[model samples]
Target: MDKNQLGVQYMQEGNWEEAAKAFNDAIEENPKDPVAYINFGNVLSAVDDDEKAVKFYQKAIEIDEHAGAAYYSIGNVFFTQDRFTEAKKMFETAMKKGLESSDNFFMLGLTLVQLNQGKLALPYLQRSVELNEHDAEARFQYGLCLAQLELIDEAILQLEKCIELDPDHSDAFYNLGVSFAFKETSVKAIEMFNKALEIQPDHLLAGHAKKLIENNL
Candidate 1:
């Protein structure tokens, strides 16, 4: 097989050094191949060499300006560094260049949320859950975005679905409790909080919420 294929195989086996060497060989094999640069960048990224990763990704973009995977990789590096603005830009460019994945959508949506642009994040988060409905984390985030928009019923559904998918998800139960509390459904809120606490006994917020609900009722 080709160097790129060997590189991918090494990566799949978690052999970082061999993977990097194979990818380096792949790049040398076809210096103008954007895919080689992107794959090299992926190896660097997996090794947490964000600075070097960006260089390879940029090289890929230089070779082919429409390298969506390169842009998405850059976005991931930026997002991890908390440079959400640049991350958002790169992710948007990736999407424009035909990058489509549940992870990409989820990260872009999460970046928007971190930027305090939850309203704008709604559609991306919704799309993420649509693409991977079994992802409890995505469902939890989608639920929060809906709650922020006062779409209580919609938020409740997502949070409930999250709990169904992962019964040990304490935060999902806690958020569901908060949603119910926001709607003045005290009994239901208390029950949700109790469930959350049951799942995670050390969940301080859940314990507090349960007591607060009981006292008020």
Candidate 2:
């Protein structure tokens, strides 16, 4: 395989040192290849060297202004640091630069959610789910945003799909319970809460909601 592809394989195996070395070799072979710089930046990011990672990403961007993956990598670093606004800008730029990957859309949506702009996050989250139907987290997040927007039915559908994709996801069960409760289907809500508790006995919200409903009944 080519050095860049080998680097990516190393990265997938979580061998950051080897990945970095492979990427370094790739860069040496082709100094202007933005992909190598972005791959190296990812390795740096994996090692928690955020400052170095950003520099590498910036170098990739400098080499090719259209390096959408570089912007996406920088966005991930900013997101981890809770720099929501900067993360949002980077993700947006990635999107504008033709990064139509599901991950990029998901990160942008999540950034908007972190910034308390759930309304604005909805479409992006929906697009992310549309792009990758098997992504349980994306579906869960979309469900959550829909619930927050008082679109209970839509929330329930997404949460149910999320649960189907990942049956062990306690949070999805709990959220499904909440959505059912919003629709006044107390029996279904209680069943969902019980399922959540079965998956995660320490699910505080599910426990509380179950107790509250029992008391009322």
Candidate 3:
């Protein structure tokens, strides 16, 4: 395999040192290749070297102004740092640079959610789910954005699909309980809360909601 592909395989195996070596070789082989710089940045990012990662990503961008993956990687760094506004900008730029991946849409949507712009986040999150139907986390986030908008039924649908894709998702179960409670379906709400508790015994929200509902009933 080529050095870049070898680097990616090493990354997938969680061998950061070898991945870095492979990427370094790739960069040495072709200094103008933006993909190598991006891959190197990803290694640094995985290792929690955010500052160095950003520098590598910047180098990729310098080599290729239209490098969408570089922008996307930088956005991820900002997102992990909770710099949501900056993350939003980078993801938007990535989109404008022709990166229409599901992950780009998801990150942008998630950034908007972090910024308390649920209404704005909804469409991007929806598009992410449309692009990758099997992504449980995307479904869960879309459900959360819907819930925040007071679209409880739609939220419940998404949350249900999330749990179907990932049955052990306690958060989805807990949120499902909340959605059912909003519909005044106490029994179903309690059942969902119990399911959440079964999955995660220390789910405080689910426990509290169950008690609150029982007391009211």
TM-score of each: 0.91, 0.98, 0.99
Q: Write the per-residue lDDT of candidate 3 for residues 29-80, one digit (tens) a residue.
A: 9999999999999999999999999999999999999999999999999999
Task: Write down the worst ten-residue block by lDDT for model 1.
Answer: 208-217
The reply for model 1, stretches above 4 Å from the true place, is none
Tell me how many residue pairs clash in candidate 2. Answer: 0
lDDT of model 1, residue 83: 99
The top-ranked prediction according to lDDT is: 3
Which residue ranges in model 2 land beyond 4 Å of their true spot? none
User: What is the Å distance of residue 96 in model 2 from its true position?
Assistant: 0.7
Cα error, candidate 2, residue 27 (Å): 0.7
Consecutive 10-residue window with the lowest summed lDDT within model 3: 144-153
lDDT of 2 at 7: 95
Against the correct fold, how does model 1 do in TM-score?
A: 0.91
